[model samples]
Target: MERLFGRAWLVLGHESQVLAPGDFLTTRMGREPVIVVRHVDGSIQVLVNRCAHRGSRVCEGPRGHARQLVCPYHGWTYATDGTLCALPLAEGYDRSPIGVEELGLRRVPRVETYRGFIFASLAPDGPSLLEFLGPLRASFDDLVERAPAGEVEVAGGVFKHAYRGNWKLVLENHNDGVHPAFVHASSIWAARNGAPWDVWEKTGLWVARYGHSWMGDYHDDTRLVAALDHPVFREYRAALERRLGPERTARVLGELRWNSLVYPSCSFMSQFRQLRIIHPIAVDRTVVHAYSFRLKGAPQQMFRDTIAFANVVNGTASPVLTDDLEVYERVQDALTASRNEWVELGRGHGGDVPDRDGTLRGRTGTSEIHIRNQLAAWLEYLDMGGPEGRADAPAMAPQSAQRSEAPRQSRNAPRPA
Candidate 1:
């Protein structure tokens, strides 16, 4: 775990989450407790959430705004920049070899933000965020460009939940469309009952550079969107048309390419306007944190839809996602069986075509290309080192066992509104 995570660039939080001075959000960068805070001057800082004096957490909540972080154990204080600013007794420290400056909250070493997304690295040196993200950058582009003003703000609030499973299990599941028909049979019975067939026919998978992969639509299915007939959605569509023109607006909002997972920690599906974080709590447990976004300059109802879509798809009690969580726990339990050795990554094997960027996309959506791609990345990180050591691998594209099959049509008819 340390080798896989401790040396990589991980997301701390979004810039919008802590927009105001002193606004802070607590999160886990791997197993380490981290605080993403904004200072009065507007600079962002990521501080380790431990007190220099007694090793207690200076900031003890999930989120809060504070002038400074004061240790609950002692009076030692730190500025929003993580600079040690105060101590209860100066004379006591004068006798010690360390100065107050030496005792400031430890910074995460390398902190950077790209397009309002904040990330930190524990290792001192590695690829820049640009190199690390590579083609996955398009996901952010598709997300932000959906806004008429070309921007998005984290709105509504965050939804946090967890499942009893390995962290990789969630990442694999994010793009594993073959399971919805079985695992999620009850929840999506009306639409996705025969998931391998239904989802396979509708969703095509794309693998991008740096192990980032996503599922795009094989055919236009606007029923889910058109059914969202509300004053807010109408206004939002009109606003998008004014900025993006009619054809483009339809392509952007009407056809959603959902479940874009940026390897290691986060996934954002712009069509749904939702972002989810996969935090590894242990070898067998994972916490998922989700947030909804409001495209700046879009209709207010659009933000409401973002929340509604997330609730149905990934809410704490989501009718859809809860089914997956239960299966993940059960799968984690089932793996303990003596006969279990390896899980299948052979779905739709060999259906991938080169994406021309050292990555490949599946000819069929049901292909295990996405899962195998991520596991390849995981092995690379755990063995070869993170992004820094990935360049030496065989184009970093692990080809599935050679085979080919045409997609089957979905058996279930579209559900009525």
Candidate 2:
């Protein structure tokens, strides 16, 4: 955790969760608990939830509006900005070198927001959030620009689930492209006769620097934006056209990206308006929080469709999600065996073509290039020297299995949002 999430920029929550002064939501940076609050000064603060006095957690609830944070264990009161304001029996530590002024909650070193999504980093210094986001910022733009009012907010609450599997499994599965055919066979059968396997051929799989990757939409009528004949969808499009004009509206809706991974912590779908944050608790356990967004100024049915998509695809009761979860646990269980020492990620190897935009595109949509790119970034973050010097080198396939030339291309290529 210290090497991966501890030093990386992680998503805390959305700005809407703490919009008003004193509104706060509790989340975590890896395993360390944190409170994201809106201060009276109108600034957002990400503070450690541990009390300054005895290291007890000051905030217990998931979310609330509070004037100040008070530890139930010792009744130590702290201001919204994390300044220690009051404590019972002040004479207890009269001679101690530590003063009340120094007991405020420790603020995270850096906090930044892209659009309405907030991110915090525990590390004191590194690449700025924009530098880290690189080309993936367009994914966020694709989401927010869909709203006629030019904003999107978290809505319909959040769906949280825990699984007995490594956190990396979920991120890898999001863009695997090959798993849904077998894993979601039941859901496909129930929805219709079978899956549209041909959609894979039309979609594009893109991998960028920092392990971020996204796939183009299926472009079939089953997509969220494909209901052109529905009056609600027409209204929604007209609203967007009024705000963005015909040309910009065409460009915005023309974006076909589906699932986008902001490496290490976040995965989102622009079309369905769903955002999920991955929280790693232990090596074999993880929790995910799924949130649905409501586009401002869009038709009410649009938000309803967003909720329906969440319930059908992301909710705990979802057949589609449960199938993936079961597979995750099964994979975890089998991985403990001593039989296999390496996980092969060589599907579509040597077939990732270079794009003019500097990203590596899988030769086919069903390739495992996304996983290889993610593991390469994983090694970079852990500072484990490439496959040559690492002790656990056998755990991975090989360095040549990944697209090594793409980074050189990315370094000099112009980043397109």
Candidate 3:
């Protein structure tokens, strides 16, 4: 765990989560709890969730608009900006300064926002979010740029679920396209019970640089492609054709389905209109948060289609996801056996092509290239030393109750990117 935390990229929330003044949310970095808040002055701040007074936590709620964060332990109150505000029954000591600044919440060392998402680094130095995003940034821009409104937000409440497997398994599965045909046989059968085989085979899947991948031509269900295709999907293709010309649009649209593993934690299924975040809980447990977004300015049917897609592919009860989860859990269980020294990542090992960027890519769905890339990043982050070094192991477990406000200092700090 120390090795894992040492070089871990402790990125938490994006800037859009705290859009309004007093809007705040709590997230964890490793085992440390962090509170991100939009201050009264309209600035965003990230702080530790621990209270300065009596070492008790400040806020206990998950999220809410609050002018002040009042600690329930000793009645210590703090302004939204993390300034220590009021303590009950003041005026006991005249010789000392007990003002807000003195007791202000502990602030994260470095905070940066990229593309409206906020990130903090516990370490004073590391790659910026843009640098960290690397090849994944282009994929994110492509998704948002396709939107006529050129913006996206977390639309509905997030769906939080737990996986009884190593977090890495879930991360690897995000871009693993090979499992769909075999593991998702039920879904594929249901999707094509009355449809044609050629159309199903025509649906293209693509793997991108640095573990980012997607499937394309999803609408080629023979039924839909036999028609003119949905107007919105048609418009999306047409606009791309106009911008990049017919040949390029054919190349781009014919390739790629999901845009996932945006480095470190986040994975986006652009076509499904949902993003899934992988949060590590322990050696054998992971908490996944799935967020669906309403594409701003998109047709209502588009959002509905996205929800339906989510239900079919990403829902907890979906045949595809259920089988995948079973495999992951079994893998975790098997790895604990005495025989296996390391999980094999040897598939499609040397076949990766070096792109213009420094990242590597493998062509086939059978490749474990994405898993290799993720482990590479994970190893790099864990070597840098982190919260696990503290005398007291950070509370990596989930708190039974939600916490609202926390001290800016003494909380877990962000790790390098």
Q: All candidates' TM-scores?
A: 0.87, 0.90, 0.78
Let me know the TM-score candidate 3 reaches against the reference structure.
Answer: 0.78
lDDT of 2 at 415: 25
Flag the better candidate by TM-score, 1 or 3. Answer: 1
* Residue 105 lDDT (model 3): 79
In terms of lDDT, the best-performing candidate is 2
Q: On lDDT, who's better, 1 or 2?
A: 2
lDDT winner between 2 and 3, please give it.
2
Q: Which tens-of-lDDT digit does each residue in 258-301 have in candidate 1?
A: 78888888887867778888899988999998888889998776
Error of 3 at 198 (Å): 12
**lDDT by candidate, in order shown:** 0.75, 0.83, 0.62
Candidate with the greatest TM-score versus the true structure: 2
Stretches of model 2 off by over 4 angstroms after superposition: 95-101, 219-228, 384-417
Measured with C-alpha atoms, the lDDT of residue 229 in candidate 2 is 74
RMSD list, candidates in order: 7.3, 4.6, 9.3
Report the C-alpha displacement of residue 360, candidate 2, in angstroms.
Answer: 1.5
Clashing pairs in 1: none
